[model samples]
Target: MAKVIVYPPTSMILYDLVERMGHKALVVSEAVRNLVTASGIESPPLNVTPEEPKKGLRYAAVDVPSGVRGRMALIGPIIEEAEAAIIVEDPGWLTGCSGCSRTNELVRLLIRTKGIPVLDLSYPTNDDEAKVFVQKIRTFLEGLK
Candidate 1:
Protein backbone atom coordinates (compact mmCIF):
# COMPACT_ATOMS: atom_id res chain seq x y z
CA MET A 1 0.00 0.00 0.00
CA ALA A 2 1.12 3.54 -0.77
CA LYS A 3 1.18 6.39 1.73
CA VAL A 4 -1.24 9.14 0.77
CA ILE A 5 -1.88 12.58 2.29
CA VAL A 6 -5.27 14.08 1.56
CA TYR A 7 -5.68 17.86 1.54
CA PRO A 8 -8.57 20.14 2.49
CA PRO A 9 -12.13 20.84 1.39
CA THR A 10 -12.84 17.12 1.23
CA SER A 11 -16.34 16.33 2.42
CA MET A 12 -17.10 13.33 4.62
CA ILE A 13 -18.53 11.66 1.57
CA LEU A 14 -15.22 11.90 -0.26
CA TYR A 15 -13.08 11.11 2.76
CA ASP A 16 -15.07 8.02 3.64
CA LEU A 17 -15.02 6.87 0.05
CA VAL A 18 -11.22 7.07 -0.03
CA GLU A 19 -10.71 5.39 3.34
CA ARG A 20 -13.24 2.64 2.65
CA MET A 21 -11.22 1.82 -0.45
CA GLY A 22 -8.36 0.90 1.93
CA HIS A 23 -6.08 3.85 1.38
CA LYS A 24 -4.33 6.10 3.87
CA ALA A 25 -5.44 9.72 3.86
CA LEU A 26 -4.31 12.64 5.98
CA VAL A 27 -6.72 15.48 6.52
CA VAL A 28 -4.75 18.75 6.31
CA SER A 29 -6.95 21.29 8.05
CA GLU A 30 -8.44 21.53 11.54
CA ALA A 31 -11.93 21.86 10.09
CA VAL A 32 -11.39 18.90 7.82
CA ARG A 33 -9.84 16.93 10.63
CA ASN A 34 -12.93 17.43 12.70
CA LEU A 35 -15.11 16.53 9.75
CA VAL A 36 -13.20 13.32 9.09
CA THR A 37 -13.12 12.34 12.74
CA ALA A 38 -16.81 13.05 13.09
CA SER A 39 -17.37 10.72 10.18
CA GLY A 40 -15.30 8.03 11.96
CA ILE A 41 -12.19 8.29 9.79
CA GLU A 42 -8.98 8.15 11.78
CA SER A 43 -6.90 11.21 11.00
CA PRO A 44 -3.62 12.50 12.32
CA PRO A 45 -3.02 16.06 13.44
CA LEU A 46 -1.70 18.19 10.60
CA ASN A 47 0.18 21.34 11.58
CA VAL A 48 -0.67 23.75 8.82
CA THR A 49 0.46 26.74 10.89
CA PRO A 50 4.07 26.73 9.78
CA GLU A 51 2.97 25.17 6.51
CA GLU A 52 6.20 23.29 6.13
CA PRO A 53 6.40 20.29 3.85
CA LYS A 54 6.43 16.91 5.51
CA LYS A 55 9.09 14.67 4.05
CA GLY A 56 8.20 11.29 2.46
CA LEU A 57 4.52 12.01 2.09
CA ARG A 58 2.56 11.91 -1.17
CA TYR A 59 -0.15 14.57 -1.15
CA ALA A 60 -3.51 14.72 -2.90
CA ALA A 61 -5.22 18.08 -2.55
CA VAL A 62 -9.04 17.90 -2.75
CA ASP A 63 -9.56 21.09 -4.67
CA VAL A 64 -7.66 23.94 -6.27
CA PRO A 65 -8.86 26.42 -3.67
CA SER A 66 -7.37 25.10 -0.46
CA GLY A 67 -8.43 28.21 1.56
CA VAL A 68 -4.85 29.42 1.77
CA ARG A 69 -3.81 32.74 0.34
CA GLY A 70 -0.71 33.83 -1.62
CA ARG A 71 1.30 31.58 -3.92
CA MET A 72 4.15 30.82 -1.59
CA ALA A 73 1.92 30.39 1.40
CA LEU A 74 -0.20 27.91 -0.55
CA ILE A 75 1.73 25.97 -3.19
CA GLY A 76 5.29 26.30 -2.00
CA PRO A 77 5.47 23.37 0.38
CA ILE A 78 2.70 21.29 -1.19
CA ILE A 79 4.37 21.34 -4.59
CA GLU A 80 7.63 20.36 -3.00
CA GLU A 81 6.10 17.30 -1.36
CA ALA A 82 3.21 16.23 -3.53
CA GLU A 83 3.67 13.29 -5.88
CA ALA A 84 0.28 14.07 -7.32
CA ALA A 85 -2.50 16.57 -6.64
CA ILE A 86 -6.21 16.23 -7.26
CA ILE A 87 -8.00 19.45 -8.08
CA VAL A 88 -11.68 20.07 -8.66
CA GLU A 89 -12.34 21.76 -11.96
CA ASP A 90 -15.09 24.35 -12.05
CA PRO A 91 -15.25 24.34 -8.29
CA GLY A 92 -18.58 25.29 -6.79
CA TRP A 93 -16.97 27.87 -4.54
CA LEU A 94 -15.11 29.57 -7.34
CA THR A 95 -18.28 30.91 -8.83
CA GLY A 96 -18.39 33.94 -6.52
CA CYS A 97 -14.84 34.25 -5.25
CA SER A 98 -12.04 36.00 -7.10
CA GLY A 99 -9.49 34.74 -4.58
CA CYS A 100 -10.40 31.18 -5.45
CA SER A 101 -9.74 31.88 -9.10
CA ARG A 102 -6.23 33.07 -8.31
CA THR A 103 -5.61 30.11 -6.10
CA ASN A 104 -6.81 27.79 -8.81
CA GLU A 105 -4.39 29.31 -11.29
CA LEU A 106 -1.51 28.90 -8.89
CA VAL A 107 -2.44 25.28 -8.31
CA ARG A 108 -2.50 24.63 -12.05
CA LEU A 109 0.87 26.31 -12.46
CA LEU A 110 2.47 24.35 -9.66
CA ILE A 111 1.21 21.03 -11.00
CA ARG A 112 2.37 21.85 -14.51
CA THR A 113 5.74 23.20 -13.45
CA LYS A 114 6.47 20.34 -11.09
CA GLY A 115 5.25 17.79 -13.62
CA ILE A 116 3.13 16.16 -10.95
CA PRO A 117 0.15 14.21 -12.20
CA VAL A 118 -3.02 16.22 -11.49
CA LEU A 119 -6.38 14.47 -11.39
CA ASP A 120 -9.26 16.82 -12.00
CA LEU A 121 -12.21 15.74 -9.85
CA SER A 122 -14.42 18.63 -10.96
CA TYR A 123 -17.72 18.90 -9.09
CA PRO A 124 -19.10 15.87 -7.34
CA THR A 125 -22.38 16.25 -5.46
CA ASN A 126 -22.99 12.60 -4.65
CA ASP A 127 -21.31 9.24 -4.22
CA ASP A 128 -21.94 8.32 -7.85
CA GLU A 129 -20.38 11.58 -8.96
CA ALA A 130 -17.35 10.87 -6.78
CA LYS A 131 -16.71 7.46 -8.32
CA VAL A 132 -14.76 8.84 -11.24
CA PHE A 133 -12.61 10.90 -8.87
CA VAL A 134 -11.99 7.85 -6.74
CA GLN A 135 -11.06 5.79 -9.78
CA LYS A 136 -8.64 8.45 -10.92
CA ILE A 137 -7.01 8.43 -7.50
CA ARG A 138 -6.81 4.65 -7.52
CA THR A 139 -5.30 4.67 -10.99
CA PHE A 140 -2.72 7.22 -9.94
CA LEU A 141 -1.80 5.21 -6.88
CA GLU A 142 -1.59 2.02 -8.96
CA GLY A 143 0.94 3.59 -11.26
CA LEU A 144 3.24 3.90 -8.29
CA LYS A 145 2.99 0.20 -7.53
Candidate 2:
Protein backbone atom coordinates (compact mmCIF):
# COMPACT_ATOMS: atom_id res chain seq x y z
CA MET A 1 0.00 0.00 0.00
CA ALA A 2 1.13 3.55 -0.67
CA LYS A 3 0.79 6.68 1.42
CA VAL A 4 -0.67 9.21 -0.98
CA ILE A 5 -1.11 12.83 0.05
CA VAL A 6 -4.13 14.73 -1.31
CA TYR A 7 -3.84 18.48 -1.50
CA PRO A 8 -6.19 21.46 -0.89
CA PRO A 9 -6.13 20.26 2.74
CA THR A 10 -9.71 19.13 2.10
CA SER A 11 -10.65 16.94 -0.85
CA MET A 12 -12.93 14.08 0.03
CA ILE A 13 -12.99 12.71 -3.51
CA LEU A 14 -9.23 12.31 -3.70
CA TYR A 15 -8.99 10.95 -0.19
CA ASP A 16 -11.75 8.43 -0.70
CA LEU A 17 -10.41 7.39 -4.09
CA VAL A 18 -6.98 6.68 -2.64
CA GLU A 19 -8.39 4.63 0.22
CA ARG A 20 -10.79 2.69 -2.01
CA MET A 21 -7.86 1.69 -4.18
CA GLY A 22 -6.11 0.16 -1.11
CA HIS A 23 -3.80 3.12 -0.46
CA LYS A 24 -3.57 5.40 2.51
CA ALA A 25 -4.75 8.95 2.02
CA LEU A 26 -2.70 11.15 4.31
CA VAL A 27 -4.70 14.35 4.56
CA VAL A 28 -4.81 17.34 6.87
CA SER A 29 -8.05 16.16 8.39
CA GLU A 30 -6.07 13.37 10.01
CA ALA A 31 -3.98 15.94 11.81
CA VAL A 32 -7.11 17.77 12.83
CA ARG A 33 -8.52 14.53 14.10
CA ASN A 34 -5.39 13.92 16.13
CA LEU A 35 -5.50 17.35 17.64
CA VAL A 36 -9.13 16.98 18.54
CA THR A 37 -8.76 13.51 19.95
CA ALA A 38 -5.53 14.26 21.81
CA SER A 39 -7.35 16.73 24.03
CA GLY A 40 -9.54 13.85 25.22
CA ILE A 41 -12.49 16.18 24.77
CA GLU A 42 -14.64 14.77 22.00
CA SER A 43 -16.01 18.19 21.16
CA PRO A 44 -16.28 20.57 18.25
CA PRO A 45 -13.29 22.68 19.10
CA LEU A 46 -9.74 21.49 19.62
CA ASN A 47 -7.36 23.03 22.13
CA VAL A 48 -4.20 23.64 20.11
CA THR A 49 -1.49 26.22 20.46
CA PRO A 50 -0.36 28.30 17.50
CA GLU A 51 3.29 28.53 18.24
CA GLU A 52 6.04 29.56 15.83
CA PRO A 53 6.45 27.42 12.73
CA LYS A 54 8.84 24.51 13.04
CA LYS A 55 9.89 21.87 10.56
CA GLY A 56 8.44 18.37 10.96
CA LEU A 57 5.83 19.58 13.45
CA ARG A 58 2.12 20.42 13.22
CA TYR A 59 1.40 24.11 13.32
CA ALA A 60 -2.11 24.94 14.51
CA ALA A 61 -1.70 28.57 13.58
CA VAL A 62 -2.31 28.58 9.83
CA ASP A 63 -1.64 31.85 8.07
CA VAL A 64 -2.32 31.77 4.35
CA PRO A 65 -0.26 34.82 3.38
CA SER A 66 2.55 34.06 5.80
CA GLY A 67 4.60 32.83 2.84
CA VAL A 68 5.50 29.23 2.04
CA ARG A 69 7.30 28.71 5.36
CA GLY A 70 4.16 29.37 7.37
CA ARG A 71 1.98 27.33 5.05
CA MET A 72 4.54 24.54 4.97
CA ALA A 73 4.31 24.23 8.73
CA LEU A 74 0.79 22.96 8.19
CA ILE A 75 1.64 20.46 5.44
CA GLY A 76 5.41 19.95 5.15
CA PRO A 77 5.47 17.12 7.66
CA ILE A 78 2.86 15.19 5.75
CA ILE A 79 4.65 15.80 2.44
CA GLU A 80 7.97 14.73 3.93
CA GLU A 81 6.52 11.34 4.74
CA ALA A 82 4.36 10.82 1.68
CA GLU A 83 5.20 7.97 -0.69
CA ALA A 84 3.07 9.36 -3.51
CA ALA A 85 0.65 12.20 -4.17
CA ILE A 86 -2.60 12.99 -6.03
CA ILE A 87 -3.01 16.74 -6.47
CA VAL A 88 -6.31 17.90 -8.01
CA GLU A 89 -7.30 21.45 -8.72
CA ASP A 90 -10.08 23.33 -10.54
CA PRO A 91 -10.45 27.03 -11.15
CA GLY A 92 -14.17 26.67 -10.56
CA TRP A 93 -13.64 25.19 -7.12
CA LEU A 94 -13.57 28.26 -4.93
CA THR A 95 -13.24 26.41 -1.68
CA GLY A 96 -10.98 23.59 -2.82
CA CYS A 97 -8.42 25.83 -4.53
CA SER A 98 -5.47 27.25 -2.67
CA GLY A 99 -6.06 30.66 -1.16
CA CYS A 100 -2.51 31.74 -1.91
CA SER A 101 -1.04 31.03 -5.33
CA ARG A 102 2.52 31.17 -4.01
CA THR A 103 1.74 28.77 -1.24
CA ASN A 104 0.09 26.44 -3.72
CA GLU A 105 3.14 26.55 -5.98
CA LEU A 106 5.40 25.81 -3.03
CA VAL A 107 3.31 22.82 -2.09
CA ARG A 108 3.42 21.51 -5.66
CA LEU A 109 7.19 22.02 -5.73
CA LEU A 110 7.56 20.07 -2.51
CA ILE A 111 5.43 17.25 -3.89
CA ARG A 112 7.57 17.08 -7.02
CA THR A 113 10.73 16.76 -4.93
CA LYS A 114 9.30 13.79 -3.03
CA GLY A 115 10.62 11.59 -5.88
CA ILE A 116 7.29 9.82 -6.13
CA PRO A 117 4.56 9.32 -8.69
CA VAL A 118 2.17 12.26 -8.72
CA LEU A 119 -1.25 12.34 -10.40
CA ASP A 120 -2.10 15.95 -11.00
CA LEU A 121 -5.63 16.45 -12.31
CA SER A 122 -8.15 19.10 -13.01
CA TYR A 123 -11.54 18.65 -11.44
CA PRO A 124 -13.85 17.10 -14.00
CA THR A 125 -16.59 19.22 -15.44
CA ASN A 126 -18.52 16.52 -17.26
CA ASP A 127 -19.40 12.89 -16.73
CA ASP A 128 -17.07 11.73 -19.50
CA GLU A 129 -14.12 13.59 -18.10
CA ALA A 130 -14.96 12.35 -14.64
CA LYS A 131 -14.76 8.74 -15.74
CA VAL A 132 -11.50 9.33 -17.58
CA PHE A 133 -10.07 11.14 -14.58
CA VAL A 134 -10.84 8.26 -12.25
CA GLN A 135 -9.41 5.80 -14.77
CA LYS A 136 -6.18 7.76 -15.00
CA ILE A 137 -5.95 7.92 -11.23
CA ARG A 138 -6.49 4.18 -10.89
CA THR A 139 -3.87 3.52 -13.54
CA PHE A 140 -1.40 5.79 -11.81
CA LEU A 141 -1.90 4.13 -8.44
CA GLU A 142 -1.65 0.65 -9.88
CA GLY A 143 1.59 1.59 -11.61
CA LEU A 144 3.14 2.98 -8.46
CA LYS A 145 4.53 -0.33 -7.28
Candidate 3:
Protein backbone atom coordinates (compact mmCIF):
# COMPACT_ATOMS: atom_id res chain seq x y z
CA MET A 1 0.00 0.00 0.00
CA ALA A 2 1.19 3.53 -0.71
CA LYS A 3 2.07 5.88 2.12
CA VAL A 4 0.05 8.98 1.25
CA ILE A 5 0.47 12.22 3.12
CA VAL A 6 -2.57 14.47 3.14
CA TYR A 7 -2.09 18.23 3.33
CA PRO A 8 -3.33 19.99 6.49
CA PRO A 9 -2.61 16.61 8.09
CA THR A 10 -5.47 17.18 10.54
CA SER A 11 -8.29 16.21 8.22
CA MET A 12 -9.95 13.06 9.49
CA ILE A 13 -11.88 12.72 6.25
CA LEU A 14 -8.69 12.66 4.25
CA TYR A 15 -7.22 10.17 6.67
CA ASP A 16 -10.22 7.90 6.47
CA LEU A 17 -10.40 8.11 2.69
CA VAL A 18 -6.74 7.18 2.35
CA GLU A 19 -7.11 4.19 4.66
CA ARG A 20 -10.41 3.13 3.12
CA MET A 21 -8.69 3.09 -0.25
CA GLY A 22 -6.10 0.61 1.06
CA HIS A 23 -3.27 3.14 1.49
CA LYS A 24 -1.48 4.30 4.62
CA ALA A 25 -2.16 7.92 5.59
CA LEU A 26 0.75 9.69 7.19
CA VAL A 27 -0.91 12.25 9.44
CA VAL A 28 -0.05 14.68 12.23
CA SER A 29 -2.29 13.09 14.84
CA GLU A 30 -0.29 9.89 14.65
CA ALA A 31 2.92 11.86 14.99
CA VAL A 32 1.56 13.71 18.01
CA ARG A 33 0.48 10.41 19.51
CA ASN A 34 4.01 9.14 19.14
CA LEU A 35 5.47 12.19 20.83
CA VAL A 36 3.09 12.13 23.78
CA THR A 37 3.30 8.40 24.19
CA ALA A 38 7.07 8.22 23.87
CA SER A 39 9.00 7.72 27.09
CA GLY A 40 10.45 10.81 28.90
CA ILE A 41 8.04 13.45 27.68
CA GLU A 42 7.03 15.29 30.84
CA SER A 43 5.56 18.48 29.46
CA PRO A 44 2.10 19.36 30.79
CA PRO A 45 0.56 20.12 27.44
CA LEU A 46 2.45 17.26 25.81
CA ASN A 47 2.02 18.95 22.47
CA VAL A 48 5.63 19.53 21.50
CA THR A 49 8.55 17.89 23.15
CA PRO A 50 11.72 19.97 23.69
CA GLU A 51 13.72 18.02 21.16
CA GLU A 52 11.07 18.34 18.50
CA PRO A 53 12.26 21.76 17.33
CA LYS A 54 15.83 20.54 17.09
CA LYS A 55 14.67 17.70 14.88
CA GLY A 56 12.88 20.24 12.73
CA LEU A 57 16.17 21.91 11.86
CA ARG A 58 16.59 19.23 9.25
CA TYR A 59 13.71 20.76 7.35
CA ALA A 60 13.76 24.41 8.45
CA ALA A 61 16.34 26.95 9.52
CA VAL A 62 17.35 27.69 13.11
CA ASP A 63 15.98 31.21 12.77
CA VAL A 64 12.46 29.99 12.02
CA PRO A 65 9.70 30.24 14.60
CA SER A 66 9.76 27.48 17.18
CA GLY A 67 6.12 26.70 16.48
CA VAL A 68 6.80 26.15 12.81
CA ARG A 69 9.94 24.20 13.56
CA GLY A 70 8.17 22.10 16.12
CA ARG A 71 5.39 21.35 13.69
CA MET A 72 7.85 20.59 10.92
CA ALA A 73 9.58 18.13 13.18
CA LEU A 74 6.47 16.03 13.09
CA ILE A 75 5.48 16.70 9.49
CA GLY A 76 8.84 16.81 7.70
CA PRO A 77 9.61 13.18 8.19
CA ILE A 78 6.15 12.23 7.03
CA ILE A 79 6.68 14.22 3.84
CA GLU A 80 9.96 12.47 3.31
CA GLU A 81 8.27 9.13 3.75
CA ALA A 82 5.37 9.89 1.45
CA GLU A 83 4.96 7.79 -1.65
CA ALA A 84 2.01 9.92 -2.75
CA ALA A 85 -0.02 12.84 -1.47
CA ILE A 86 -3.48 14.42 -1.64
CA ILE A 87 -3.83 18.15 -1.03
CA VAL A 88 -7.24 19.82 -0.85
CA GLU A 89 -6.95 23.52 -1.48
CA ASP A 90 -9.12 26.03 0.38
CA PRO A 91 -10.39 23.43 2.80
CA GLY A 92 -13.12 24.66 5.10
CA TRP A 93 -12.09 25.81 8.55
CA LEU A 94 -13.83 22.88 10.19
CA THR A 95 -12.46 20.44 7.70
CA GLY A 96 -8.70 21.01 7.49
CA CYS A 97 -7.58 24.21 9.10
CA SER A 98 -4.03 23.82 10.41
CA GLY A 99 -3.72 27.37 11.86
CA CYS A 100 -0.19 28.11 10.67
CA SER A 101 0.04 29.83 7.32
CA ARG A 102 3.84 29.70 7.14
CA THR A 103 3.94 26.06 8.06
CA ASN A 104 1.13 25.35 5.68
CA GLU A 105 3.00 27.00 2.81
CA LEU A 106 6.20 25.25 3.75
CA VAL A 107 4.49 21.89 3.94
CA ARG A 108 2.91 22.40 0.53
CA LEU A 109 6.24 23.43 -0.97
CA LEU A 110 8.02 20.42 0.43
CA ILE A 111 5.39 17.97 -0.69
CA ARG A 112 5.07 19.42 -4.18
CA THR A 113 8.83 19.32 -4.69
CA LYS A 114 9.25 15.84 -3.26
CA GLY A 115 8.94 14.19 -6.70
CA ILE A 116 6.09 11.91 -5.75
CA PRO A 117 2.69 11.57 -7.32
CA VAL A 118 0.46 14.28 -5.86
CA LEU A 119 -3.21 14.99 -6.42
CA ASP A 120 -4.27 18.58 -5.78
CA LEU A 121 -7.99 19.15 -5.50
CA SER A 122 -10.19 22.04 -4.45
CA TYR A 123 -12.34 21.72 -1.35
CA PRO A 124 -15.85 20.70 -2.25
CA THR A 125 -18.47 23.30 -1.45
CA ASN A 126 -21.65 21.37 -2.29
CA ASP A 127 -22.99 17.86 -2.48
CA ASP A 128 -22.19 17.43 -6.13
CA GLU A 129 -18.68 18.74 -5.66
CA ALA A 130 -18.21 16.48 -2.66
CA LYS A 131 -19.06 13.45 -4.74
CA VAL A 132 -16.57 14.52 -7.38
CA PHE A 133 -13.92 15.06 -4.74
CA VAL A 134 -14.23 11.52 -3.47
CA GLN A 135 -14.18 10.09 -6.95
CA LYS A 136 -11.08 12.07 -7.79
CA ILE A 137 -9.33 10.88 -4.65
CA ARG A 138 -10.27 7.30 -5.36
CA THR A 139 -9.00 7.57 -8.88
CA PHE A 140 -5.72 9.09 -7.78
CA LEU A 141 -5.13 6.52 -5.07
CA GLU A 142 -5.85 3.70 -7.46
CA GLY A 143 -3.33 5.12 -9.91
CA LEU A 144 -0.51 4.95 -7.36
CA LYS A 145 1.75 1.95 -7.60
Candidate 4:
Protein backbone atom coordinates (compact mmCIF):
# COMPACT_ATOMS: atom_id res chain seq x y z
CA MET A 1 0.00 0.00 0.00
CA ALA A 2 1.20 3.49 -0.79
CA LYS A 3 1.79 5.95 2.01
CA VAL A 4 -0.23 9.06 1.14
CA ILE A 5 0.62 12.26 2.95
CA VAL A 6 -2.35 14.60 3.27
CA TYR A 7 -1.78 18.30 3.77
CA PRO A 8 -3.62 20.52 6.29
CA PRO A 9 -2.44 17.71 8.61
CA THR A 10 -5.94 17.43 10.02
CA SER A 11 -8.24 16.62 7.14
CA MET A 12 -10.25 13.64 8.41
CA ILE A 13 -11.82 13.10 5.01
CA LEU A 14 -8.44 12.54 3.41
CA TYR A 15 -7.31 10.35 6.26
CA ASP A 16 -10.40 8.18 6.00
CA LEU A 17 -10.22 8.02 2.24
CA VAL A 18 -6.60 6.94 2.30
CA GLU A 19 -7.42 4.13 4.71
CA ARG A 20 -10.52 3.13 2.77
CA MET A 21 -8.36 2.75 -0.29
CA GLY A 22 -5.95 0.52 1.70
CA HIS A 23 -3.29 3.18 1.98
CA LYS A 24 -1.86 5.10 4.92
CA ALA A 25 -2.01 8.86 5.51
CA LEU A 26 0.92 10.28 7.38
CA VAL A 27 -0.68 12.95 9.53
CA VAL A 28 -0.22 14.83 12.82
CA SER A 29 -3.74 14.27 14.10
CA GLU A 30 -2.69 10.88 15.40
CA ALA A 31 0.21 12.49 17.21
CA VAL A 32 -2.18 14.95 18.81
CA ARG A 33 -4.43 12.14 19.86
CA ASN A 34 -1.54 10.25 21.39
CA LEU A 35 -0.41 13.33 23.28
CA VAL A 36 -3.86 13.81 24.73
CA THR A 37 -4.34 10.21 25.62
CA ALA A 38 -0.91 9.88 27.17
CA SER A 39 -1.20 13.06 29.17
CA GLY A 40 -4.30 11.94 31.10
CA ILE A 41 -4.14 15.34 32.74
CA GLU A 42 -6.10 18.46 31.91
CA SER A 43 -3.33 19.81 29.70
CA PRO A 44 -0.38 18.44 27.75
CA PRO A 45 2.94 19.80 26.62
CA LEU A 46 2.68 21.24 23.14
CA ASN A 47 5.08 19.42 20.83
CA VAL A 48 7.97 19.47 23.22
CA THR A 49 9.86 16.23 23.55
CA PRO A 50 13.15 15.15 25.09
CA GLU A 51 14.45 14.42 21.61
CA GLU A 52 13.58 17.92 20.39
CA PRO A 53 16.84 19.67 19.80
CA LYS A 54 17.41 22.95 21.57
CA LYS A 55 17.77 24.18 18.00
CA GLY A 56 16.10 23.03 14.79
CA LEU A 57 17.82 21.51 11.83
CA ARG A 58 16.94 20.84 8.23
CA TYR A 59 16.71 17.33 6.84
CA ALA A 60 20.29 17.76 5.67
CA ALA A 61 21.46 18.38 9.26
CA VAL A 62 21.93 22.07 8.47
CA ASP A 63 20.88 24.28 11.35
CA VAL A 64 17.74 26.33 10.89
CA PRO A 65 15.58 28.46 13.16
CA SER A 66 13.95 26.60 16.02
CA GLY A 67 10.50 27.59 14.77
CA VAL A 68 11.18 26.05 11.39
CA ARG A 69 12.61 23.00 13.11
CA GLY A 70 9.47 22.53 15.17
CA ARG A 71 7.25 22.71 12.12
CA MET A 72 9.49 20.50 10.05
CA ALA A 73 9.61 17.81 12.69
CA LEU A 74 5.85 17.60 12.49
CA ILE A 75 5.81 16.28 8.96
CA GLY A 76 9.31 15.89 7.55
CA PRO A 77 9.59 12.22 8.33
CA ILE A 78 6.16 11.62 6.87
CA ILE A 79 7.18 13.35 3.65
CA GLU A 80 10.22 11.13 3.33
CA GLU A 81 8.11 8.07 4.05
CA ALA A 82 5.31 8.97 1.68
CA GLU A 83 4.80 6.85 -1.42
CA ALA A 84 2.27 9.30 -2.87
CA ALA A 85 0.46 12.50 -1.93
CA ILE A 86 -2.99 14.07 -1.80
CA ILE A 87 -2.56 17.80 -1.29
CA VAL A 88 -5.80 19.67 -0.53
CA GLU A 89 -4.83 23.31 -0.56
CA ASP A 90 -7.80 25.41 0.57
CA PRO A 91 -6.49 28.95 0.73
CA GLY A 92 -9.96 30.40 1.28
CA TRP A 93 -10.09 28.97 4.80
CA LEU A 94 -7.57 30.89 6.84
CA THR A 95 -7.34 28.24 9.53
CA GLY A 96 -7.34 25.38 7.05
CA CYS A 97 -3.85 26.16 5.85
CA SER A 98 -0.63 25.02 7.47
CA GLY A 99 0.45 26.70 10.73
CA CYS A 100 2.75 29.06 8.80
CA SER A 101 4.16 29.84 5.38
CA ARG A 102 7.52 28.22 6.08
CA THR A 103 5.90 24.91 6.91
CA ASN A 104 3.72 25.13 3.83
CA GLU A 105 6.66 25.82 1.54
CA LEU A 106 8.76 23.06 3.06
CA VAL A 107 5.96 20.51 2.67
CA ARG A 108 5.52 21.33 -1.01
CA LEU A 109 9.26 21.16 -1.56
CA LEU A 110 9.57 17.80 0.14
CA ILE A 111 6.72 16.35 -1.87
CA ARG A 112 8.01 17.72 -5.15
CA THR A 113 11.52 16.41 -4.63
CA LYS A 114 10.28 12.90 -3.99
CA GLY A 115 9.05 12.52 -7.60
CA ILE A 116 6.07 10.37 -6.59
CA PRO A 117 2.58 10.26 -8.05
CA VAL A 118 0.41 12.98 -6.55
CA LEU A 119 -3.18 14.12 -6.68
CA ASP A 120 -3.21 17.87 -6.18
CA LEU A 121 -6.62 19.31 -5.30
CA SER A 122 -8.11 22.40 -3.72
CA TYR A 123 -10.41 22.47 -0.73
CA PRO A 124 -14.05 22.50 -1.70
CA THR A 125 -15.97 25.70 -1.15
CA ASN A 126 -19.44 24.12 -1.21
CA ASP A 127 -21.30 20.89 -0.66
CA ASP A 128 -21.16 20.02 -4.35
CA GLU A 129 -17.46 20.62 -4.43
CA ALA A 130 -17.07 18.52 -1.32
CA LYS A 131 -18.68 15.60 -3.05
CA VAL A 132 -16.46 16.08 -6.03
CA PHE A 133 -13.46 16.31 -3.73
CA VAL A 134 -14.17 12.89 -2.22
CA GLN A 135 -14.71 11.29 -5.57
CA LYS A 136 -11.58 12.81 -7.02
CA ILE A 137 -9.44 11.66 -4.11
CA ARG A 138 -10.99 8.21 -4.21
CA THR A 139 -10.26 7.81 -7.88
CA PHE A 140 -6.73 9.02 -7.51
CA LEU A 141 -5.95 6.68 -4.60
CA GLU A 142 -7.61 3.66 -6.20
CA GLY A 143 -5.56 4.23 -9.33
CA LEU A 144 -2.40 4.03 -7.25
CA LYS A 145 -3.37 0.64 -5.83
Which of the numbered candidates is closest to the native, going by highest lDDT? 3
Model 3 CA RMSD to the hidden true structure, in angstroms: 1.1
Task: Please give each candidate's TM-score.
Answer: 0.49, 0.77, 0.95, 0.78
**Candidate 2 per-residue C-alpha lDDT over 29-80 given as tens digits, one digit per residue, 9 for 90 to 100:** 7766666677455544543343324432342234544444544665777887
- Please provide, for model 1 over 1-145, each residue's C-alpha lDDT reduced to its tens digit, 9 standing for 90 to 100: 3333333333344445445656543223433344345644443343233332231122334343334442234344545655555555665643222244555565466566776555666666689877876787677666643
lDDT of 3 at 101: 89
Residue-level lDDT of model 3, residues 48-126, one tens digit each, is 8678889999999999998899889989999999999999898977877567989999999999999999999999889
Off by over 4 Å in 2: 40-48, 52-71, 91-99
Report the lDDT of model 1 for residue 117. Answer: 58
Q: What is the C-alpha lDDT of each candidate?
A: 0.47, 0.70, 0.90, 0.72
Worst 10 residues of 2 by lDDT: 52-61
Reference-based lDDT, residue 87, model 2 = 81
Clashing pairs in 2: none
Clashes of each: 0, 0, 0, 0
lDDT of 1 at 35: 39
